[model samples]
Target: MTETKKTTIVLFSGDYDKAMAAYIIANGAAAYDHEVTIFHTFWGLNALRKDEPIAVQKSFLEKLFGKMMPRGANKMGLSRMNFAGMGPQMIKHIMKKHNAMPLPDLIELAKEQGVKLVACQMTVDLLGLKPEEIMDGVDYAGVAAYLGDAAEGNVNLFI
Candidate 1:
């Protein structure tokens, strides 16, 4: 017998750790044949834009400056995770070596695996993002719409 399952992830952080964690979980859930959905808002919106490139800080000054910069969501800037001494470089290297896939690719895979991707309209306006900025295969909707879907699922995670 095939038992269906539902899981929803409401991602609110734009940092690398949060983004990657969400992708990992989404991929795992899809692998298990569970229906998955991702709702992105605030800083999380950064991950949805196809044209929004994530800049790599080249030096200590740049990194420090980035720290002072107002991160769009969660009172934190979209900084990369430091994996001990190796830092973001090591993290990226390991991910590439493992063929773990990029966040955008994971998102696409999730969608291909029947995972729904939703972008919050309010965050769009707040961030001054246009409809064209969103990636292909994404649905733009208000928080209520996401809540409606989330309310029906067995699991909902805020990353």
Candidate 2:
């Protein structure tokens, strides 16, 4: 019998391009029959956020944070040359012109491909993010869970 392959990625960056890279890799690994897990921590958790605002009550600080951070993948700024938020728009246009998948679409494809998408519970709490503010079909766990997945993965990456 053959052993199954495992791939685990720790997505720690909030940068749009970096998150796209992480999701692309996860999807590729899943296509190759690997057990894939993406651990979204800190700013990375933004990738799982819903594009629309959720009417949830929050502390003052929480509200401030929500206002400062991008609401979803499409709203996230690029790692470099953001140029007052025009960089992402230009990239999206280029991607569409080439028939390339956007970050949000890549994430959806990953979910459809059965790639495990996990949001760091601790990070969520720390960021004052409510479960209602995140998209559906995501698992919540802490560092220990991420470590366990990473331990079993033949390929491990931190984005």
Candidate 3:
């Protein structure tokens, strides 16, 4: 019997370009019949957030976090040369010109390709992100869950 190859990525950055890189790699691995898992923690969770606010009950602190953080991948900024948030826009325009997929489309493609998307349960609590605030088809897990996959994976990356 053959063992399934695995690829585990720890997505710890919120930058638009960084998140795009993570998803691009994840999707590529999945295409090669690897079991791909992306564990999103810290600011990386912003990449999995929904574009619009979901009607969910929240405490004062949770509400504050909701209001302060970027709503989704579309709102994520670049890691450098952001120039007051114009960097991502410029990059997006360039990507379109080259006929490359946008970050949001890449994310959806990863999901459609059966890549497992995990949100850090601990960070979710720390950031006060409600369940409804997250995108659908994501699993909520702790570090142990990520470690389980990483331990047996042939490829492990931190993005």
TM per prediction: 0.74, 0.98, 0.95
Q: For residues 1-159, what per-residue lDDT tens digits would candidate 2 score against the true structure?
A: 488899999999988999999999999999999999999999999999999999999999999999899998999999998889999999999999999899999999999999999999998999999999999999999989988989888999999
Which structure among the candidates has the greatest lDDT?
A: 2
Candidate 3 weakest ten by summed lDDT: 61-70
Model 1 alpha-carbon drift over 4 Å, by segment: 1-3, 52-86
Prediction 2 TM-score vs. true: 0.98
For all candidates in order, the CA lDDT equals 0.70, 0.94, 0.93
Q: Which scores higher on TM-score, 1 or 3?
A: 3
Ranked by lDDT from best down, the candidates are: 2, 3, 1
| lDDT of residue 23 for candidate 1 | 74
Clashes of each: 0, 0, 0
Candidate 3 global TM-score? 0.95
Name the lDDT value of residue 72 in candidate 3: 93
Candidate 1 lDDT tens digits, 1-159:
465777889888777668778978988998998788888888787677654434542466544544443333223233544544345456666878998776657767787887788888887666666666566787888878887877877778988
Clashes of 1: 0
